[model samples]
Target: MIVKKTDNGLVMDFPALPYHKIEWSPQLQALNLKQPCVIAPYWCDRLGTPSIKARQGGRRQGELLCEIKGNRVLLYGSCHLYLKGTIYLP
Candidate 1:
């Protein structure tokens, strides 16, 4: 993963493949759900179901745009796994 510091927060660039899952530790998951969380997928303008449900054939790339404000964490990006949007923290 390539992490780049930005004025808002950080941008993480990582390789992603179809059906690839990004799992978080139990402790982190608990801490993250302490606040309101929202998830928004990229490429929503595209037709058909979300990428998470679609079958990806080859290696694809995506990014994670992360921003923090006070106690909230906002994440938005695109990938085969379709993990994008806002997440709250305790």
Candidate 2:
């Protein structure tokens, strides 16, 4: 992954396929608790829609509604996304 330090924070770049699942490490989670971040797709081969969901007690909660099309990212739920991003909590 290529990470760039920005004035606001950091921008990370990585290649991913459809249905790719990204899990956060414990250390990373401890660093950014209740902090807001942005995720966006860059130079993707195809368009994809991603959803973020919170989990507790080994059960998955409802999916945070979102829509991604072209270069626009729309978040309808309490979750956040830029181009196409999702967050899963355990």
Clash number for each model: 0, 0
TM-score of each: 0.28, 0.22
Model 1 C-alpha lDDT per residue in residues 4-74, reported as the tens digit of each score:
45585433333323233545432233224431123213321222213222111223332344334444555
**lDDT, model 2, position 83:** 58
What local lDDT does model 1 show for residue 77? 40
Top candidate, metric lDDT = 1
Query: Which residue pairs in candidate 1 collide?
Result: none
Tens-place lDDT per residue, model 2, 12-81, is 3333222224443322231234211234333122223243221111122221223346555443333333
Residue 51 lDDT in model 2?
Answer: 33
Q: Lowest summed lDDT over 10 consecutive residues: which window, candidate 1?
A: 48-57
lDDT of 2 at 38: 37
In model 1, what lDDT does residue 40 have? Answer: 17
- Candidate 1 residue-pair clash tally: 0
